[model samples]
Target: MRIALATATGAAVLAAGAAITTVTPAYAAAAIADIKIDTTVSFIPPSGSDSIPFTVKVNSPYTGSKAPDIKAEFWKEGEATTSAGHAASVTALSDLANTTPAPTPASSVEVKGSIPVSSSDKPTTSTGKWTLKVSAYPDGSTTAVSSDTATFEVKAATRVTSANVDPDPVYLKSGKEVDVYAGFHLEKFGDEKITDVRLESKDSDDYYSLSTGLEADDSYHDSTSMDYSTSTGSWQLRISISRATKKYSFTKAFQVKKSGSSKAKSKITLYASPSKVKKGKATKLYGKVYRGSKAWSKKILKLYFKKKGTSKWKFVGYVGATSTGKYTKSVKPKYDGYWRTTAAATSLTSGSLSNIKFVDVK
Candidate 1:
């Protein structure tokens, strides 16, 4: 009986050792779910408008039976600008919905939809490239840990033909308001929506206002209006839009006469033409006044352009003012990016920026 008991005890110990050898160490926290955006461009015939048919691809390397849900979004590159750490002229194209998970590995999954073409989405600068971002969310978790991005270009349907701003010389007194008019036209190239009209001027003051659903009056094609009361003699008025995909713009100027009881006097009005510019090309800008069309003296007006992320402002040479109340300047860009410019006045008060505009460089 003692021998039998000894053999049984030995067998039990061997069994325990085998069990320990068979077990494995826990996998380092299932590598946060991974995902990617896969897309291809297809053109609608005759129209030749570029459209994206995109799908989200997910990978679950872990041994788990179920996968997590993923979310996604799309953004245009180089749409916003900044000067001295302040934000200006930020814009977007589209926001897409999150996709459900696929049931099997290596099986293709996609969000059911198409990116639309519009009049506003026409590429004005930098080949109009945009990026699509996709992110994954694990089930029952608020934290989204996994993400990926895809890059593509938006083709131009129409290029900006001409842009001008008005009132040769816009004269105003300090604390007095004036309406600056810009005339522009759009060439129907793509099918994107161009929206959200605005005028912005900033210099460490953080002052900005947005006007929605406003377009250049029907009477004037390719134009919009804004109200500005000059706080200082020299200031910049930036004209911007809400949506800019396939959107090209040109401007012509119109002035608001000055009113009395204003704190100061503005002898001239200066501003950017086409408000937006395409990178690497020379864009024409005009400065005008209301000194009764006698035109400001032919002095070279100093101007500068700066991108959103950097601290430096590039000096765009002095623009000569026309005797007919207009100052004309040409801007050539060194990089494919988004930028805004400010024009300083010599003896102006009520008028700073007669207007603003935008162009896509890439």
Candidate 2:
């Protein structure tokens, strides 16, 4: 019985070795499926320089009983075929493979490596796709059996899209507070989805936040208002953006002018009934002109309507002040569209326009 058991064990070992040698698994050689790599890259670099990071991974066939050894490398495609040494050069990362035992049943062996930016690489250049190829080989095999490849892009070092500061050069008086808005503009890498933004403002804690990630198509307004009421002087606004590791910055100066008693503040009060007005309909419009000290007593107010399709405007009517500062005019719509009315307060210098009321007429 002992002899029979020993014979069976020896036969089993021999059979396993034979299978590993003879069976050519589907992914037993260098093939595209045996490799993995990161497709996205981000970073910031000095002007006239370029840097990129990438990862390469090796994978073995899932169905093979004998785990395979794998090696990875990078190569240039297209015109860059000759630039990348016509093949991957062992720099920071080298061709390495996993030589350990399999972890579980149906599990494939794997290895990974990261390629960092090297000083030797072309600065501000190497603008093409670099393919990462992963190769696999069976144990005791002298050549690669399968391989896979991935691609990456190398770009310029410093990238500045729209770099500017807001509240741009304003004046404020001592003990006079004024609110100012700052804005920045930019466009890069074919409409980049801005991620991870940072702002550094001058005066540190005294100022507000910075604005980044402005949409290429839409205007970006940062609500960073400044108040120079306490101290009258000049200040700077610094803005910075860290998009995907690429940094850009700009700054502007503003001032606070000294002033005295506030000017007589005059307001034009606009009164419009049926705040919601639809197109193509007659509606009554009212406007009142008021000054900081007293109400406007007499003024000639004109009513005009511009149809949606045409640029020419027709004078619908006019409201001449017969009483105090109040004036009213009733007019009908020419077409189904939006209309606006302006009240020139000849009586007072304060001119006011009523809120745009939408008039929808069927």
- Predicted model with the maximum TM-score: 2
lDDT of 1 by residue, 165-228 (tens): 4443445544545445444444333443435333322211322333323244322232333334
Candidate number with greatest lDDT: 2
All candidates' TM-scores? 0.26, 0.38
Error of 2 at 310 (Å): 92
Candidate 1: Cα lDDT at 322: 53
lDDT (C-alpha, whole model) for all candidates: 0.41, 0.46
Looking at model 1, report the run of 10 residues with the lowest lDDT sum: 1-10
Q: Weakest 10 consecutive residues, lDDT, candidate 2?
A: 1-10
lDDT of 1 at 42: 24
Cα lDDT for residue 196, candidate 1: 36
Tens digit per residue, CA lDDT, model 2, 175-234: 545566655454344223333233232212234554455655644556544454322233
